[model samples]
Target: MNAPPQEEATSAARVLVAEDDDAMRAMLVRTLRRAGYTVVEVEDGFELGDYVAMMRGHGGTLAPPDVIVSDVRMPGLNGLEALGRLRAQGVACPVLLLSAFADEETHAEALRLGARQLLDKPVDLDVLKAAVRDAVARG
Candidate 1:
């Protein structure tokens, strides 16, 4: 047996959701919480930056979230740029990028910049859960 599936995460994993769409962001947060994760929400890149900085300034809240799930396209700054900035700021957390328009080029670039996973939109819940688990495991 491949060691039966894990029922719970090794750590208390929290997730940070960076999505500009109100409904989508809310849905992602709800879905994650239902899967037993703690979640925080950020609407855009600047807000995302502020959250990370706050966490860094103070040790961090809820372990700085084990993973970051961001929408690919957003106002002000997009997900890819956010990921790059986070990396520049020494964020080691795994980031999963989501896009309604996920094409080969996008995936290649995101992986190159260290994104842990990518999900094409409409967001399947089961797959999302599995991806979250794997990303948290990697962390």
Candidate 2:
């Protein structure tokens, strides 16, 4: 007998989050999911790179996330560095970079690296949702 047809995945936006803080990561995941987006949570930029590479290795069979939300500082590569690398690799997904210690230089660098927005830490969930929505619409 043939297997039953599977239902299509929801058309909700896909958002990948890279944050080292457990509590903050959880909050982001919860908020984004509650907002009806498909959220992928990672611990740091290194893991974020791994996820992106994995998707690329699938040769376009797997779709990359519509947006990436990453913290400025982490154990491994920082958000700016990761964003630069992703851009170098031709990943065109919009990025929303979050930082507790962001400065003017960092903001400039993020813009140079093609980040869609730089959000300071203790981010407001509503603002984040709006940014994500804007990123998706722009893309």
Candidate 3:
């Protein structure tokens, strides 16, 4: 037997969304919230970095979000840069990076930095939802 959709929604997996575009961020937040994820939105890489730092509890008591969905290109730190910093600090949470114009090198770096997935822009909502679910389940 499987849990009902309503019951699953109550699982409330936390998702951090980092995107510089206001419209895209809003859309991603709406999609994740509707899918029953507790979504946190950050406008740029700096905000993402700050949130991770604040959640990086002393003695490793605090845990990061279940997954992070970030845009690869942003002012200041960028998603790859943010992911690198987080990995350096031992944040092992799954990350899904989005890009409108990523080259092969960018893809290689994302993989090297331990991102779970690299999604292209104009992301399919269904794919995004599935990726988040997979990330949470894998964790």
| CA lDDT of each prediction against the hidden true structure | 0.84, 0.84, 0.87
Model 1 per-residue lDDT tens digits across residues 1-139? 3643455563357899999889989989998888888788899877876676667624566356789999988886788987887788687889999999989999999999999988999999889888998888777
Residue-level error in angstroms, candidate 2, position 108: 0.5
Off by over 4 Å in 3: 1-10, 57-62
Indicate which candidate wins on lDDT: 3
The candidate scoring highest on TM-score is 3
Where does candidate 3 have its weakest 10-residue lDDT segment? 54-63
* Candidate 2 per-residue C-alpha lDDT over 6-107 given as tens digits, one digit per residue, 9 for 90 to 100: 211223678999999999999999988887779989997678767766777345445778888999899878898888777877889899999999999999
Q: After TM-score superposition, what is the CA distance of residue 40 in candidate 3 from its true location, in Å? A: 0.8
Error of 1 at 139 (Å): 1.0
Q: Please give each candidate's TM-score.
A: 0.84, 0.86, 0.88
TM-score-superior candidate, 1 or 2: 2
Note the residue pairs that clash in candidate 3.
none
lDDT of model 3 at residue 38? Answer: 92
